[model samples]
Target: MKKVILGLSALCMVAFTSCKEDASSKINSENVAAAAERDATSGDFPTITFEETEHDFGTIVNGTPVETKFKYKNTGNSPLVVSNIKSTCGCTVPSDWNREPLAPGESAEFTVKFNGKGKGAVTKSITLTTNTEKGSEVVKIKSFVEADPNAPAKTPAKPVIKQVQ
Candidate 1:
């Protein structure tokens, strides 16, 4: 019984010592100071300038597809990277965008296709995720879609007339 107790005590001591805080993995003051210095000196963010942020398709026929091109330039000191492009809905698609990083003073263009399926005034927006000062940018497209002619017309009810007795 005494030997078993001694073995148990030795095992507990070994476990406690092994679990002690490791000195080599400790976060020191020097590391914090260096991190602060790096953050303070980092300021070379990219910028994007668009030729036109919005486009109007005027009047379009329903069920027709329309497309437009949006042009942009990197007008900053650093290269601009566009990580993703998303539209307001599946009816709008952004395509042919440059996948590579755009260098300063470089220009690129992308095409946005809209399936003209809605009626009346329709508006959609496209969002771009980029490595720039704003982190993200937005562009818009709008159009007036005419009513589908093939659709059933909504007729008004005829007024009832009552003859005086």
Candidate 2:
């Protein structure tokens, strides 16, 4: 008789634990659904679309400053706000983008200036922080800096012709 009672107690405990777990899972699901509903009723998200993510400066003169602009637009359902812009190195600088929120279908451009300090094949990246769904965007600029071909050639001073033959 005692064994039967113990078995019954064990069964009851198992059932109670399972019910508790189910209730907790249901609550979690309900919370998730509620959050989704709230998001649906709230403002929509913004997306950034660029005409081109990369720009080529072509061949540039070393030691000169060159700038290129990257065009973009807000293609999502909401307005887009630019939060930050950063360059990969100190020699490269990025100009301020549209400070105001860009409404959908509006277009703008961000300018990047790279001091033509490096030579040979050069590549730089500019990172943009925005209210985009992915949170960030990256733009690339590449150039081949050629040594100034117009630099004057050095001429050796004419050897002094000794007259004291």
TM-score top scorer: 1
Lowest-sum lDDT 10-residue window in model 1: 37-46
Using Cα atoms with residue i matched to residue i, what is each candidate's TM-score against the true structure?
A: 0.70, 0.66
Report the lDDT tens digits of candidate 2 across residue range 1-165: 999999999999998777545555556777899999979956677888888898888988988899988899999888899989999999999996888999999999988999998889999999999988778899999999998878787899998887885
lDDT of each: 0.93, 0.88
Candidate 2 lDDT (Cα, 0 to 1): 0.88
Instruction: Give the per-residue lDDT of model 1 (tens digit) for 10-97.
Output: 9999998887778778888898999998687568788899999999999998988999999999998888998899999999999999
Those runs of model 1 whose alpha carbons end farther than 4 Å from true positions after fitting are 1-41, 150-165
**In candidate 1, how many Å is residue 3 off?**
24
Candidate 2 Cα deviation (angstroms), residue 6: 26
